[model samples]
Target: MNKLMILTGEPLTRSILANFFDGISDFCVEGSFEDVPGLLSAVQNSQVDVLFADAEYAMQGNFLPLINPYGAKRPLIVLLARDGQAAAKSYEMQNVIDYVIKPSTPERLFLSLQKIRMQLSLINSYEAVGAPHSPRRDYVFIKVNKKMVKLSLDEILYVESVKDYIKIVTEKKSFLVYNTLTNFTASLPEGRFARIHRSYTVSVDKIDAIEGNTVEIMTTRLPFSRKYIAENQLKVFK
Candidate 1:
C-alpha cells in the first residue's frame, strides 16, 4: 500500500482529508498535521509515498524544498491551495503530482488519490524500463492523407480514439487516421505502449500527467471514455 500524509492548518480540513482516505484500497493515511514542525524530517524518516498539504501553510513553514531534499524515494505532493494562482507557484517544485483548490470536497480528495496511485505506478514502470534515450524499436511508416509518413516510434506520445477515428499525437504534431484504437495498439511494438485507459494507448515515456480518466502528454490532455473504467486491466497500476 502507498503511505499518504496530509499537512494543512485547518482542523476540519485535516479531518475531512483523513476520513476521505479510509475507503481507498491502495492507500493508507499515516498521519495528518496542522503544523509543519518536523514535516520534512517525518517524510524522509517514514516511507511516505504521497503527501497532501495546503500551499499557504507549506510556504509559511518554509517548506520550499519539501520536494525531497533528503532524496529518499522522493515522495509525491498534492498541494491544496486557496486558488489557481497559489497553485501556479508549485510548478517550480519537483515531485508535485497535482493540486486541489481549497474547500474541496471529500470526493475530490478521493479522486486525486486515485489519480496519484495510477501516476506513481506509471513512474515505477518508467524507472524499471530504463531511461528514455535507451534503445527502442525502429520507427514505423504509416499512410496519412494518401501520403506515406515516416514516424519515429519514440516521437509518438500517445494515440487517442475519438468516435470512429484514431488520433496519433507526437511531440510536434497530431495526425488523424481512420483506425481503431485496438488496431493501433496492436501494431505497436510489444510492451512499448500501455493502454492507460480504453481509448488511450500512451507511450509510457511521454506521459506528462495522469488525472482521473484524463492522461496528459505534452500540452495536450486527452480524456478516455470513463464507461470502460471497469474493464481497465492496467498491470502497472496493479
Candidate 2:
C-alpha cells in the first residue's frame, strides 16, 4: 500500500482528511500534521508515496528544497488551496501533481485518489517492461481524408465508437475513420490503451479521474462497463 500524509494548518481539516483517507484501500495514512516541522520529520523518517498539503503550509514551509525530483523517494503532492492565487503559486513546485480547492468533499477526494492510483499503476507498468535498448513506438499512421496521416500516440486522448465508424480524439482535433473500435485499438501500443467500455477505448495516461462507471478525460466524462473494472481490478489497482 502507498503511504500517505496529510498536512493542514486547520485542526478540523486535518481530522477530516485523515478520517476520509482511513477508508481508502490503496493508501495508508502514516502521518497527519498541522505544522511543517512535524510533517517534514515524518516524511524524512518514513517512506511516503503521496502527500496532501494545504496551500498555506506549502507556501510558507519552503518544502521544495527537501524533495529531490530525480530521486525515487520523491512523494507526489496533492495541494489543497483556499484560493486560485495560492493554488497557482503552489503549482510551481515540481512534485505537485494535483490541486483541490478547499471545502473538499468525500466524492472529490475519492476521485482524486482514483486518478492518482491509475497514474501510479501506469508508472509501475512502464518500469516493469522498460529496457535500455527497447525501440520507442511513439506514433502510428492511419488513413484520413484518403491520405495516411501520422498520429502520435501521446496526442490521442481516447477512442469512441460510433456505429460503423470510430472517432479518435486528441487535445486539439479529432479524426473519424471507417473502422471498428477493436481494430483501431489493436493498432495502438499494448498496455497504453484500455477497453473501458464496448464503445470506448481510453488512453490510460490521459485519464483525469474515475468515479463509479464514469472516467473523466479532460472535460469529458465517458462511461465504462463493469466488466473492464472487474477484470482489471488487480492488474490496474494492485
Clashes of 1: 0
Across 113-202, the per-residue lDDT of candidate 1 in tens digits comes to 776878788657756774575566456545465333667889998888887567888878898864457665766776567776667888
Ten contiguous residues with the weakest lDDT in model 1:
64-73
The TM-scores of all predictions, comma-separated, are: 0.50, 0.51
In candidate 2, how many Å is residue 205 off? 33
Q: What is the lDDT of residue 87 in candidate 2?
A: 81
Off by over 4 Å in 2: 69-73, 131-238
Question: What do the candidate models score in CA lDDT, each in turn?
Answer: 0.69, 0.75
TM-score of 1: 0.50
